[model samples]
Target chain A: MAIVVVNVMPKPEILDPQGKAVTNAGKRLGHEGFSVRQGKRFEIEVGEVTPTVLEEVRHFAETLLANTVIESFEVCS
Target chain B: MRVGVVTFPGSLDDADARRAISLTGGEPVELWHASDDLRGVDAVILPGGFSYGDYLRCGAIARFAPVMDQIITRANQGLPVLGICNGFQILCEARLLPGALIRNQVQTFTALDQPLRVESTRTAWTSAYWEGQTITIVLKNGEGNYQADPDTIAQLEDEGRVVFRYLGNPNGSLNDIAGITNQRGNVVGLMPHPEHNVDPTITANLDGRPLFTSLADYLLGATC
Candidate 1:
């Protein structure tokens, strides 16, 4: 079984509402160093997960997990 | 015609999408996230909302849903696949459509009756409108601006793949693109909610009705 970690985010130019909301809230609370965005992680156990299998998994994540419009994904084993 | 609408965990518009299909004279079948089968539907619609609560990006997590596998396979076989908002994001992630929905350059979640120019009536969806015709539909999303590398944008422009353009730039999308059709013209992705426009009780504009109407016309024996 291999573990996969994926990080997804809107491309730099895109506005992140959730991030912005957090940033604003941090400012209100006087929290320092608040530059925040969000993404997710999924851990799955697969059989002999070769590179091709990983790619397929990534494609699956691309098609379903992350919205490609605003988010990009990177997969690590 | 029978249509399948896939439901990701956080999908918010699956029910509405089904209702829209019913209103348009298509039978809507619900497919689950983990199942790879398409339930023998003629077309597929990836509805809007934060799948996985936008946990890993809007449509990121939903892309891996088993149903999408079937969708991608059948879409290549010439099945119609329509992605709206978050659904559009999933298509982009899937590479079935090029470009990405970035955060609105203005950084705002815009929800309103947005005006769009029908750039092409050549796809499985949006076939009811005349080229260059304008219509209004509801657009509500936080990350909906469309962008791509310079060459890709130019290619899309040159190919006339752009299917919809904003009547007025609302999300800071390049060239005001609100929707696009894939090379085969069977897959389409748009940021607006045509489903919301199907019922007058739900939306002020009926402009979105044509989207479904055209789908009904073609899927149920109407001309291209």
Candidate 2:
């Protein structure tokens, strides 16, 4: 199965260095209404993928991969 | 003793960490982030920098580097491991230690010589220091604030797990915590850069030398 770990961070309440840089470059490229929030995306190939396994992995990401203080994550197929 | 300095992509202080370990009379071995073997080093130092480009948050992507597999194993076996700044974030990311480093209170990269109070000398890295002794070390990072659930913080405090506290609130960390040691004292993570202050010319007062010296004194029987 294709297991993906998408690291999520808050969308800019305003002032995201990575996002701002992207937006500026996008505007220069003539792509208006472009916005982004910096985040991490990891693709892991595991032995098997199951609901229990997904929950376990989600918990792992919650405690390790993503900071809950200002960040959250989701597991998708 | 031989110490291993693991270099993940974007890691900036690998050389400085090597130099500090060498000055302490311990041989420094270069370990790669994608390798699972430690090459028989006595201890490991995860130097500061934007590992994995600080993607998915600082130290997050690099937490799963192949080297971390062995680091987890060795650290679990009581091998000494010290994580600095970005390295500190990785330790938390890898669950080798506890707590997470959040953004600075002011949300800007703060770089300066910060004074920190040594909270405990029980760890291999801090044994050279006296409890409550304050020393100045350099701090540089955008995401260095430390945050933990209240229960976790209380547990750490009640168990004397906190190892250092910043005299100046450079990052707005909870309890001004600058460093913490695991229950075994074998794994430690701190926000400041002790490796950067190893040289007298760099620190001007040689304040950060004791951390390396103390570790060498314990694991290698050699100290400057």
Candidate 3:
């Protein structure tokens, strides 16, 4: 079995209110000099790890897992 | 005409949508999210709610439901579909519409009887209203802020696809767009709940009834 991981993040230009709020809360809690950007991670286990399967998974990640209009996604093996 | 109101597990306004359809002289049909059948309805309404508990992003998981597959199919074939609030999110996630609804810029859930201006009435759902007509509808959602690429905003504006614009820019949407229609004009997604204001018993003014009546007329006219 092969595990495919995808990270979906808000585009850099889009405002992430949750991440900003968390950043503010973190500063209040005494953390300093750093920022956080929130995102989603999904791990899928596939029965077979053929090149065709990987390509298909990439298509799914692009079309279903992430909306490219305001977000971008990365696939990690 | 029969209007199908889809009931996702967490849909809060399906009944209201059904009632609105009835008040506008159309038959209301209940459709299940887990089933692919549309019951051969003339149109479909994805009512507002936190479907799939809004997990992993709003409408992210629900967009893959079996019913959505068929909805997308029929929508491509010119089915009139209206997505309200969370339904709007689903439409965006399904890529039927062109933008994403993030959290409100103020980071708070906004609830109000907001005024909106009908920017265009060429859509299947807005033909009953005159251009520039103003109406009041219920708006309540945490993730109602709309965002898209600049080019997409220009395209939407150029194509005259923006059907509704907020009079007072409540949620910080780009171009104050409260609602937009697909290129074909048959599918629409909006951040307000028109169904909630369709009846006089619920709302003092029946501003939302025209939206339903518009759809009813469009479908009936198509058959005649």
Question: What TM-score does the predicted chain A of each candidate obtain versus native chain A?
Answer: 0.78, 0.78, 0.91
Candidate 3 chain B has its poorest 10 consecutive residues by lDDT at B198-207
Against the hidden true structure, what lDDT does model 3 obtain?
0.91
Which digits, one per residue and each the tens of the lDDT, describe model 2 over residues B119-196?
999898998889999898889999888887778899999999999998978867888899999999888899999888
Better of 1 and 2 by lDDT: 2
User: Which model scores highest in lDDT?
Assistant: 3
The clash numbers for all candidates, in the given order, read 21, 0, 0
Please, what are the lDDT tens digits per residue for candidate 3 over residues B57-125?
A: 788888999999999999998999999999999999998998899999888999999999999898889
Colliding pairs, model 2: none
Say which prediction, candidate 1 or candidate 3, comes out ahead on lDDT.
3
Q: Judged by lDDT against the true structure, how good is candidate 2?
A: 0.83
DockQ, every prediction: 0.33, 0.15, 0.73
lDDT of 1 by residue, B1-51 (tens): 888888998889999999998887788999888998888888889999899
Give me the runs in candidate 2 sitting further than 4 Å from their true place: A1-65, A68-70, A74-77, B220-224
Q: Deviation in angstroms for B53 in model 2? A: 0.8
Kindly report which residue stretches of model 3 are placed more than 4 angstroms away from their true locations once superposed.
A46-53
Best by TM-score: 3
